[model samples]
Target: MNALKNEADNKKTIAIIQTTRIGDLLQTSHAVKLLKENHPEYRVVLVARKKFATPIMFLLEKVFDKVVTIEHKTAMFGADNVREALSKLKKQLKEINEQNIDVSINLAFSKSATYLHSLIESSNKVGPYFNDLHERVITDRWSQYLYSTVMRGDLNPFNLVDLFSSIIGTTKKLTHLSNKDYSSEKKTNLLIHPFASNEKKMWKANRWVEVIYQTLKKNENVKVYICGSNQDQKSADEILNSELIRPFKDRVNLWIGLDLKELYSKVDSSFLFVGHDSMIGNLLSFKNIKTLTISLGTVRPHETTPYALDNYNLAPKTECAPCFPKDECTEFKCHNDVPYNITHQCIGQLLNNNKINIEELNSSCSSLSLSRVKLYHSDMLDNGDLYIRESLHKDQDAKEVMRNFYHIAWTSIFTEINTSMDIPSFNIQTKAQLSSQSKGIETLYELSEFGKKYSRYIIEEISKNTPSLEEIRKFSAKLDEIDRLSDLVSTSYPLLAPVIDFAKVAKNNLQGNNLVKLSEAAFYTYNEISLMCSVLYEFFEKCSLINKSKPEARENI
Candidate 1:
């Protein structure tokens, strides 16, 4: 054991854990590069999900000593599945243990993160908690987690490359560490990531239409390159087919489904990146290239916005606010309403500003705080003044109320489709189905007169005595405290601790609910509630049977 320990102490072993989606994996890859560059001698290993392993593995092949792939989903879900995943993880742990890993950085923040510390056998485990997040010196922004050294804020927003580099202690600059070297080429083509992950996040097609028109009108020598995943080919094709955009088709090149390295090479060569708040925009910042990103909703530029070398972000003010899981609006009015002229004017200004050296332009990126934004409130609730006034006397009826509840549920389910699929490109049938189902629920809600009347009755009865959201939260926390106390009491008895613990868990989940990610809290609470309800119902039924049997015995007496 002394010899083994001595051998482990001789080498500096670092393990990076970021087993999430493709975008997150890519972001953490830059950190690996920075680590290798800074220390050069330390042995580094990256733990990635199977799906994200391929592209990032290929990118970081030469940077790290080894790439470790984990079955990300199995480890993420339940305790049993996590145990099973850990069994496989033990082998890697045994290997890294032999080397005595000095540092472990977790890029993901989930319930399963604790498992990584034990499996890796590392002394230093740093990551984001609800507290103790990191701050990047270059970007001057607090990173999402403790070990996350990557500074990604409004002024230094990044794609995966820049994010990774920041964490590893590099200057605030984007560098594409590709296998292929292109030292002699001049980039005449501009890469455009016009589509976003969601239609609501995408700049209007007309905006793209104008960008292409103006880009060609000014720099006739410059070519346009439209980029996306294979799933996005249809949208790209539609854009290509448009007569307005088609005139420049000869000068345009659509490169979807290219290999990751090839795409990076292309993006590296491009003069500018113009897109919405997609991963592509973030990726562009890594290359240290000029870019223009259009943002919408309550997505604070400081928190989630991209970092462009020489560019600007144009987001308009709206009444609905950053109603992120918005259902009331039939169409996404946020993205639809950003003025096209504003985009064109911004692009024109940057093009004229391109006379400066690229290095100076890169350093000139500015940070816009949530408070500094004058045109719009950080939250859309500020614009609630625009909403139609409501009176206390009016209330929705039962049928209408049922319809509204149904609509909220259906919309929530449809939203789940996007999250569940995790496809980067536009999925036609699924997208259409989501839209249709949501609209269908809305139509039902509007037509259900009986639901509306019954709902009104319930509302009238509850309105005079209803608790505010804050009160509900406090009450839920108090319930959790009571359950915790009950657990302490039951532990002494030992027989009822399981039931107490179960109640404690249910109450705790209710108190820490996140309204944005409704599925996480709602699903957990509903399951716990169902179990408790079933237990109580069974207990009552047994008691009623016992009482009837006693009465029968008394009759016999």
Candidate 2:
């Protein structure tokens, strides 16, 4: 802490890099604002792409002492245009280096951002950056959490706003920008943004038409505004031309090609904002507008949903939902499953004459099976105000959530261990205990191998039209042995307790003459136990390194 204070005192220029799209850049603003408020002496600087930076230059200038723009689009044009873009980029880099930045924080996790961070001559660097060997190294714990757990795990409950705030050393609620009081405006207007960058994220044009038509029919005075950029004009036209929406054309306004200021003005005056996961939704969130987002396709509501006082998100209840962008899926059930009727109901309630009550809406709509829907609000605590909320799906069984959590946790631990195999040493007693634990993990691995073999044998027996009783008995006995070993290992290392409990539950659930079911269960158990073994192996290996490093410290242990 003293070292950090001395560093901050000596060099006060902090450079924050967020070379991403409009939404992500806007999201990073929370951290920027907090950083400025906390460290008033630190001259905060921003590095962003020119395209996005130009639109929000006014906001950035107000928050940051200086804003540096990178011509990212020109650089990516082609090989022919690369020389000029690189020359310009180099000039900008020289200007930034001249500022003698003390701290450089790369908020965007991209190859370009990492490369840029590596070039900056700063004493301290936070977030992800590339080493000389081109390996990505995340220096901050919060950033590592964002990369490892939040990006992949569905069980993560922290909002990105909270995570960003934490990374920059501020956990308090961010101070909102003062704007026109739009709360008093009548809730009859619905701002609908139907377009997203990804096709998978956009709802069917017909669905938008349905929502528009139903809203107009529900109330005579209700007006629907479809907002988008020039690129989305075609889709906006498709929705406006639909037969259902044609009659309401007089009431519907297509605010297309509006600049950032114009869009902010429209959203500010509007009563309710409804959209997919896109810049408009994020922008509205920045203004603290009441929004309802239909998160689908690759959008993870827990990660990207607009943050506001009472924003609502509707996502599918599928287990495979909120999947990775690279994950191939033929059905894309997330987009198809969101019922239009529910959307209509949500609109009606928001525009109702009575005051908005989020709790009422949540209670009434609980049966929709919207797993990741959450209400964002600030709660004051003794330490500071925080964005308090339950897990993505808090109502699910604790064990079920723990299963997913431990999988991601163990996987992340193993990945880190594999990357840097530097483990400290402990004393003789601790080394013995670690050795015993390693052996137990090896035993679990052996049990998993046997389970896999037994599953294969069961499949072979089914194929041969011969169900052997002796083989079944042997498999059951192996399962009993596995249970005993799991109990011992879990008792030694409490972290493996959940895995043992899950295995026991799964084993107990297997019943009747279900050979195929048994095979599947065996395969699943084998994979899960194998993962646990990997976790243990990495844990003991780290212990071994620790013992090797500090012989005297080991004696105290």
Candidate 3:
């Protein structure tokens, strides 16, 4: 014992980053525990997310020395918003660097997390090497290796927990239900977490009502408890209203919005959890419980199912399964496939066996679907097609593509008009106003006018029209003009003069397009023109350049 203690005392400062969600923190805690058990004195710092920080603190006592929490909001829209998030992230990296960490492990699959790893001055950094804008050099195939090691040998990379565990070291130790120190609490037969991190991932409200109804009918004694955050309370209320559940409403208790530790305590007490494919489902896997995860096509049964425990994923195989981080289908065909009947039957099977069949847990059963929108070199792609490649040519082909894209964009604008046309049924505006507004004048329209009256015609026209070859040529010419402008700004501006010189030298060294060089010259000439215009404007503002508020040319009048 003394020898083991002595070896443990020699451990170093290690940082573990899992800045995702509540379930991610719980899943990675196993690795933290493993490290702590092996090296008790190694100072472990957990960089957790703000929402789950409070819940994570309870487990920090023995496994980690410090809990550094970062607040990050997911599912944000717009490039400007994303850029602001990156700025906040840069601030976080500066703060983390103060700790002088020895080794950093990033478990979260975020480009921002990868960027953070690159910014922090750590002795050794390990994480998956994906295409990151921040860390252009540091290479680590940790996620791949992790998947190769921790999962069952025959199956492909599917289970996320096993994939995450693979990054640390290999361990076949069966992950049991979290040992919740619930000596003061009572035990429960079942826990039902119906809510998910996002609205789209949720199974239909009526389907949940039916599942609870069928489960209670099968076993009267089974204690049914609803678990979720505060956001889930409304769904729980709807479930109680179902005719099948009205009699059992009192027995079907609601335990939503409990802090992380409290939620874990509840999870520890329950025998099984009936929920969707969510972070909670993933966390339950580590706790060794029979979980019936209802996956509604946002992800695959194989790639993101519950990790390290006996669980059954109940997502029906569809043409649009595993939509991934983002769904491309405008109709959301993925969610439509998972019906109420399928969910009820899966729960029935789980109730019959009372345990998951490990053999059936393989990846082959998953409906694997990849996202159509992929990020590449700060550019966007549609279903892996490089629609917006780096501007290489000053030719007609590029111009034609741009023009066609603009024409196609009008379809979206027209859809907005079609939606607002129904607003008149609400008695919000009169027919005369709608007709007058429908004339398609925007810049001169009254602020009080409804959008349907003023903009619908123009929107419709844009939707109807297709791009011509000439239009494509004009679009490319505009881009070329912008490039020329940038070159001009670089040449004439004192602050940017060095940049222009460097670009010129680099272009010459690499033998880049001569047309680009000519464009640069034209841009510089335009900058000179702009400067002359500015001087003339200032001159005109003076009394000397004007004849009593009139220009010199109009002085005769």
Off by over 4 Å in 2: 1-11, 72-86, 171-185, 353-394, 397-557
Off by over 4 Å in 3: 1-9, 36-42, 60-62, 72-95, 98-100, 128-135, 143-158, 169-188, 267-270, 329-342, 345-353, 356-557
What's the TM-score of each model vs. the native? 0.50, 0.67, 0.52
lDDT of 2 by residue, 179-204 (tens): 23446555877888888887778787
> Best-fitting candidate, measured by lDDT?
2
C-alpha lDDT of all candidate models, in order: 0.45, 0.64, 0.47
**What is the descending TM-score order?**
2, 3, 1
Clash count of each predicted structure = 30, 11, 10
Q: Residue by residue across 1-557, what tens digits does model 3's lDDT show?
A: 01112122345667778877666676677556654554555677888776776765766554578887776454233226777767776676666777767777777756766655566676666663223333232223334233222221211222344344445433323333232322222224668888776656676678678778877776666778888778777888888778889998778888878765677666653466777745676555445555666666464454455543334555544544545545455565555565554455445545555542323422212322211111101111221111212111122122122222222221122112111100012122222322232211111111101112212222233345572445435434543443454455543432222223322332222211443343343333333323322322333233122223211111110
In order of lDDT, best first, we have 2, 3, 1
CA shift of 126, model 1, Å: 1.8
